[model samples]
Target: MEAVMSLLVGCFFAAGVYLMLSKAIIRILIGIVLFGNAVNLLIFTAGRITREAPPVIAPDMDRLTGIAANPLPQALILTAIVISFSFFAFLLVLALRTYQELGSDNTVQMRVAEPEGDTLPPLGY
Candidate 1:
């Protein structure tokens, strides 16, 4: 189980990194979201997977056969999810603005928009 969890985390991280390094804004946005998810998952996995019982305890129950899950990871994940959502929303707006300004979603075209040749004003002037 631990090995599988490690593999899953590794896969998510690799995919997120790949997407993040892409030139396309949409891919980048997705990458950021994936990265956040990966981090949350990794943290959760680190804490260890526990029982199926509800996190809250009933006073009557004397003992639980299985170990209880660490609540910190759950809380961290919830916080991360909310933060990631806000980040995704912001990225979407940023991407939309970028597309609007560039007139196309191609990053290469944007790169070429800058003057490359003898198009600059004199340095002193």
Candidate 2:
């Protein structure tokens, strides 16, 4: 099970990186999401895979009876998820604004908006 999970994590990371290097804005967004999932998987694996063990302490179960997966990674993942979600939302809004202003999603063609003329009218003349 560990081996399988490790392989899956590796694949997801690879896919995410592959998408991240693309020139398309949407692909980059997808890559970011994929990378987040890969990170979550890596943390989950670090917590150690286990069968049927609850992380919470219970009076009925002895410590020796079953080894539980660490809860710390889950909590970490949850916090990371929330932060990443906000980042993703912000990125989407930013991207939309970029598209609206630039009129293109191609990274190569996109340019920062610049005022056409260099000279400006005197402020208080």
Candidate 3:
């Protein structure tokens, strides 16, 4: 199971990176989302998935008698989900605005900051 999950994690990361390298804004946004999910899965796998009891100690026992699921990874993944969602939303809005203003989502064409021209800027003052 762990091996399968590990392979999935790698695939997600690779696909995310490939999408991110594209010139389209939408693809980049999707890549970001995929990358975030991959990270979350990685954290979950690292925490170790086992059918164990909750991390609670009985009154008769000084310590947990059996394996207990680690709570830290769950907490971290929860927080990451919230943060990543907000980030993705912001990026999506920003991309939409860029497309509206520039009339293009292609990175090659959206050169508002530096218009395409054959002439070069004057050198050193």
Candidate 2 lDDT tens digits, 31-62: 99989998988998888877756666668866
Clash count list over all predictions: 0, 0, 0
Off by over 4 Å in 1: 52-67, 111-113, 116-118, 121-125
Candidate order by decreasing lDDT: 3, 2, 1
Error of 1 at 11 (Å): 0.9
What C-alpha lDDT values do all the predictions have? 0.82, 0.84, 0.94
- Ten contiguous residues minimizing lDDT sum, candidate 1: 109-118
Q: TM-score for all predictions?
A: 0.78, 0.78, 0.88
How much is the lDDT of residue 76 in candidate 1?
A: 87
In the range 6-30, model 1's lDDT, one tens digit per residue, is 8988998999999989878788888
Best by TM-score: 3
Residue 121 error for model 3, in Å? 4.5
lDDT of 2: 0.84
**TM-score, cand. 1:** 0.78
User: Model 2: which residue pairs collide?
Assistant: none
